[model samples]
Target chain A: MAILKTENLNYVYSQGTPFEKTAVRNVNLEIEKGEFVGIIGHTGSGKSTLIQHFNGLLRPSSGKIYLDGKDIWADKSQIRQVRFRVGLVFQYPEYQIFEETVYRDIAFGPKNMGLSEQETDRRVRATAQRVGIPESMLEKSPFELSGGEKRRVAIAGVMAMEPEVLILDEPTAGLDPKGRELILNQIKEYHKTMGCTVLLVSHSMEDVARYASRLLVMNRAEVFCFDSTAEVFKRSAEIEKIGLSVPQITRVFNILREKGIDIADDVYTVKYAKEKILEYLKSGGKLQ
Target chain B: MIKDITLGQYFPGNSVVHRMDARFKLVITMLFIVMLFIGSNTISLEVGFVFTAMAYLCSSIPVKLIAKSLKPILPILAFTTILNLFMITSGMPLFQWKFIAITDEAVETSVFMIVRILLLIAGTSLLTYTTSPVALTDAIERLLSPLKRFKLPVSELAMMMTIALRFIPTLIEETDKIMSAQKARGADMDGGKIKDKVKAVIPIIIPLFVSAVRRAGELATAMECRCYRGGEGRTRMRQLKSGAADYVSLGITIFFLAAVIFINAID
Candidate 1:
């Protein structure tokens, strides 16, 4: 079932001014429930604007956004309810952390939802653990933590709300490889355990290829393609035409094929490419 | 949503007003304000109005932008109109009720006040619309350089103004982002009791404050790394100069001011 959807959605920034720009245009998208979908695009392709619409942070200039078969904007007064159901973590979320301590910051979302103090505390601790924030650091000021730790706490702030659909815009941005992997693994585990829809907006092709089951590609304020991970990677030439690239491993396979070697062209992730190479060699597959 | 603010926003253009020296424009805008108050009668204010309209046309800024800048003052306009209409009872009574009176002089005085206020806003807004903030501060620094002998730190003050103006759009964009981030977390910034509304702002304000301080620190560090000590011994890429056009513009502005003074003297 489609849990979050946008129908013919359009958004324009600073309309009626000289600086006016159409950030998102006539985008019709459907995100199924409990699916791990990765959204990829070059900068200024409306990835940020599109996700803001999903959680009611931005109202579309035209068309509608439906959350769980109901128009989220149908009742403006109840928009906050929609927000709690669809949590959005923005880029550089660490800058939004302002509470005296990590625990209070993570509990902010739950408290806004009017949860009891005890329940809010419980969720805060659980989310902290999930995001790899230690129990000892929970009492420290969020501003004092390292960049990676602060980022995890900020992510935990939204996770504590336990929304039905979580949309994170560039969650792994400005993080080291290990930090990125740690956060991505936590998100993957959260999706597995919570069974909630997850939409990860990213600029890195390898990160999404390793995790997301489906991919949505955007270009020039429009949906370029939306399909399974392997299917999207298959159109690497088309993706490249629009200033985006497929995974390095997939490009390597494509290059090997072009060099007169027969290799699996669908290899997108490093692990899958390794398995395919070993299997082909054991089967006595020879270069052309 | 915060982009609706039109005040102090510069619109790039190549009109005569845009090309005029900023220091000259600043002084002329001041003279224009003074001229507005010097005119006592409706005819005098009308002259001031005509001059402002001509300046607006010369600036080439869209009429809609002027209307937008006037929108925020609508309440003041209405309040003054009502106040003047009911308070001034010197001339023939146009309308009279139990405790309210509207006279011919009231009508004239209200029109004069409205015209004077509108002209004041339009004249100043034209200056900002045509001149960039950087040039404005540079002009201010040069104009106030005479006061530096009294240890007024004129250059430093102008440098502060320049930095403040530079960060306005950045700070506005940051505030918008932070508001959205908090709103997504269910922070109710709109539609609540008075106390609840104030409380809701805490989330947004606290984050905005934190980020603003961080940005300031980063800016200071960057400046230090670039060997910025102070405004002392600093040279500008584009020096403020008064050309022949500036002198002509100043002459025309003085002529208008003299016209207003002549009208006041005749009245």
Candidate 2:
């Protein structure tokens, strides 16, 4: 089931001006329900521009974006409803926090949805817990929190709305490795617990390889590939040609094979690579 | 909705107007303004219109850019027209309501004032559109270099203007990004009551100010890293030189000013 999709979408910045640029051109996309999809592309490859159109933050220059079989642009007046259905957390999403308290910041989206106060409060706490924001810290001003805490509050702001699809653009940007891992883990848990579609847009190969079940590769304003994670990583050479690399472990495995070691070419993550190497050693080099 | 600001925006072009020295362009623009004011009667006004049209044609800027300059000032233009319509009483009155009256002279004056304002904006916009900001600042500094005798920090002032103009687009982009982030979280900026709209802007304004302060701090550090020691011994890489085109433009402007004065004296 395609929960959110774009057909023949085209987006041009500063159109009709001398500064005109086609950021995302003639791209079609389909996102399924409950699929953790990671969009990978180098900077300015139209990753941000493309995801912005997913939630109607930007209107495409041409073609259609359909959310659950309904064209989002069919009625301009109702476009805001699309944003509520497909929530977007922009790069450095933490900077958007503005309420007096963390709780208020988290409740902002649900409140805008016009939910009852009790329902908004319930969603806020529930989402906060999922995002690992402590209940005691909810009373503090969002400005008073540390950077990582502020990030969690901002993500919780959108999560409280419980959108059918969540799209986060580089949510773990500019964080320590531990902070990055913690947030990624929580997002993975959220996807499993809520069973909602997740679209994580990132340039880091490792982050997506570790979490996303599917991958959407973008190159120069077009979709390069949209396939299962294993299938996409198998085309590491093609990915590298477009200035995007495969996971480091995948590269190590590829190098091992080039050096005459019979290692599986499909290994993408460190843990899986570890398991594969251990199994190969235990099997005493024979295939059967 | 905030992208319509075209004021002081430079469009890169290679027309003779664009290639002429910026100092000459600045001097000519002021001379043109004086000529516009000197033209008092219908004959000189028509002459002034022709002069402006010639300048526009030579500049090769798009006709639509003039309309862009007028879009944001619609309210001010309306106010100017309304104020001149009833406030000044001259010639025969066409409509009268107590103290409020619209005379034929006032109508003519209103039309003249509106055209003058539009022409003034178009003329100034031509300077910005044709010349880059770096060139404009260099021209300003050189034009005011004589004031250095009085210890007036001419280079510093010019540098300030340069940086300010350079950062306007950057700040606008930052504001747009911040607004998008907030709007994604459902900040109702557009469709709100007057009070609600103003209230909604608080989120945007606070972050913008904070980031602006941070950027200033970062800029100071970056400048110091490059061993910037003020403008005391600064030498520019591109020295300003008055070319043949500059002299020709000056000659044409001087002729137009003389023509406007000649027309006014005859009237």
Candidate 3:
């Protein structure tokens, strides 16, 4: 069954005012259970607005969202329960850290879920360890931690919820490459172990191509394409025309193809590109 | 939801009010506010209302926006009306009860009080709606330039105000983003007891404060990197100069004030 689904969703921000804008329009998507989906879009492409609807942070201007085959907004009073099931880690997640200790911060979501004290503590410690925060550091103030540590704490806060679907919007934004890799690797491991749906929203094409099985591209407030990562990269021209570029490795492959190289043009990550280049060399750089 | 705040929002336009010198607009708005209080009778208040209405029309701002500007002050208006209606008991009682009376004078005073406040807000909002904040700040600095002899930090004050105004929208945007992030964590801000409601807000407020302080530090470093000193030797891109329209508008405002005072004197 589809763990999360949106049917003809439309969202107009600042509606009925001079600044009114149609942020998301007629976006239909069904995210299957345990799917690692990557979402990519240019700025102002309604990616943020679309993710907010999944957790009931924003009610659709029109249409509906269903989680586990049930409408999220069916009962207005049950909206808070939906947030518990769908955890969202926003961009600059570190800025959302508030509790005095990193441990308390990680426990925040589970506590709000009304978990028992022991259960909350167990989940918080386990999540912190999963995110690479040492036990000694858990009792320290979150504000006293380094930027990357604070970020892990913030992400741990959501992961401790054990949500059915975890949505992260630009989780690696403004971090060093090492920090970014650390965070992404943690998320990838969590998806693998928890067997939960993960929607990774990112501007980095390389990161998404490596991690996500499928890609959802947004352009001008509508879904441009939703397909396998390789299939979407096959139409790199159309994606670029919509003001979003494919991964650097994919671009290099496209350039090689334009130069009359008889190589496959769907390589989206460095690892895949390296393998493709080696295969071409082994085949004497000629088509059999 | 915080985007609905219309306070200090400037609407870009080429209307006469938009063209009027900001310094002149500032003086006229102050005079208009003074006139609102100086006027004692219905006729004087009516003249004040007409003057404010004319200014509003000249600004060319949409009616909905002007109404939005008035929305924030609805509580203040209610308080003023209630205070005037219940406190003024000198005249004949229209409805009398034990230690509570609605008097003829009380009814008349509240009417005038409400009208004065509505006109006050409408007249001042016309200034903000028509004039951009940068121009307003420039006019303020220029107007206060003469106070340099008294060793007052006029330029510094204006610079602080400009920074404050510049960051209002940024802070509001940050607040919105943080609130969404916390809400996504299952932090229930609504549907809770009073103590729980306050506790729920801590998640939102601490992050907001942390981000705000970080931004301030970043801004300070950026300013220092750009070789920014105090406002002493800073040159302006657009100097405030009065046109013929500014003088004409100032003349009309002064004349309106005089007429109101003159009528009040006769009454």
Candidate 4:
């Protein structure tokens, strides 16, 4: 069953004013349980606005959102309950860290959920361990930790809620390559271990291709395409036309295909491209 | 909802009001405020209202925007109206109830007080609405330059004012983002008792304060990198100048003030 779904969702900023802007218009999509879904779009493409709807942070202007087969806004009083079920980790999550100790910061979400002290502590420790936060580091002030550590603690705060659907908006934004890889890998591991649905919103196509089972493309407040990663990569030209480029490996393969090379057209990662090239060479295919 | 705040927002335009020197606008606003309170009779108030209306017309700003400026003060206006109606009784009674008597004097005073408050806000809001914050700060610095002789940190004060005004929108946006972020983490901000509402806001205020201090530190470092020393020997990109329209405006304002004072004496 789909863990989260949006049906004809629409959102408008500054509605009924001169500055009114239609941010998301008639977007419909579904995330299967335990699926790692990636959302890609350029700035102002309404990607952020769309994911914000999944957790009920933003109410739909005209449609409904379902979490675990229930309308999130069905009971207005229980909207916060929906949020607990759909965890959202915002970009630059480190900026949101404020507790004196990293442990307290990570416990904030579970505490707000009215969990018992023991349960909150257990969840926080479990989440911290999942995110690779050291036990010693959890007792230190969040400000005293390194940038990457602070980010982990912030992510753990949301994870402590043990949400059924985990949504992260550019979780690796502004981090070094090593830091980015660590954070992304940790998130993938968490998703796998918990069997939770994960939605990763990113501007980097390569990152999305490496993790997400399916891809959703947004352009100008509309869903341009929603399909498997390989299927979306087939429309690389259309994606580029919308000011977003496909993964570098996909571009290289597309170029090779245009030059009449006998390589698969769906190559997205560097390792896959290398293997495809080796296989083509061994098959006595000319370089063209 | 926090993003909808338009208080102290400046609309950029090439109108005569936008072109006036900030210092001159400040002085004129002060003079206009004094004149607004000087009117004690019906004829004087009428003259004062007409004078403000003409000034408003000359500013070329929409009257609706001026009216919008009164939004934040609606409660204050209502409170003052009620207070004046009940506290002042010196004429023919309109109604009597227990210890309170609604008199014609009370009615007149309430009307005059409400009008005075509205005119005061509308006239001053014109200054902010027309002048960009940077220009206003520059004008303030220039006008207070004489205070430097008394060892006052006029330039520093103006610089602080400028920075504060510049960050109002940014901070408001940050506040909205933080609130949404917390709300996404299941922090409820709506549908709660007074204590519950306050408790719900803890998640918001903590993150907001943290981000604000971080932003401030980053801003300070950025300023330092740019070699932003104190305001000594600083040159302005847009210098203030008094043109024919400015002189005309000043003259008209002075004439209106004279008329109001003269009318008050006659009444």
lDDT winner among the candidates? 3
How much is the lDDT of residue B67 in candidate 3?
86
Model 2 lDDT tens row, A1-288:
699888899999989876789999889878889999999998989999999998889999998999999999899888778889889998888777778889988988898888999999899999988989889999998888888988888889888888889999999999899889888998899899989999999879999998999999998999999999999988898999899999999998888877888978888998888899999989786433
lDDT of 3 by residue, A106-193 (tens): 9889988999999999999899999999999988999999988989999999999999999999999999999999999999999999
Query: What residue pairs clash in candidate 2, if any at all?
Result: none
lDDT of 1 at A286: 72
Single out the weakest 10-residue window by summed lDDT for candidate 1 chain B: B38-47
Give model 3's clash tally. Answer: 0
Worst 10 residues of 3 chain A by lDDT: A279-288
- Which candidate's DockQ is highest? 3
Clashing pairs in 3: none
TM-score of chain B of each: 0.97, 0.95, 0.96, 0.96
DockQ (0 to 1) for model 1: 0.82
Candidate 4 residue lDDT tens string, B10-105: 878778888888888888888898898887888777777887787778788887677677888999999999999998979999999898899999
Work out the TM-score per prediction. Answer: 0.97, 0.92, 0.96, 0.96
Better of 2 and 4 by TM-score: 4
Candidate 4 lands at a TM-score of 0.96
**Candidate 1's residue-wise lDDT over A212-261, tens digit each?**
99999999999999999999998898899998988888998888888988
Worst 10 residues of 2 chain A by lDDT: A279-288
Q: Candidates' lDDT values, in order? A: 0.91, 0.88, 0.92, 0.87
Per-residue lDDT, model 2, residue A53, is 92
- Alpha-carbon deviation at B2 in model 1, angstroms: 2.1
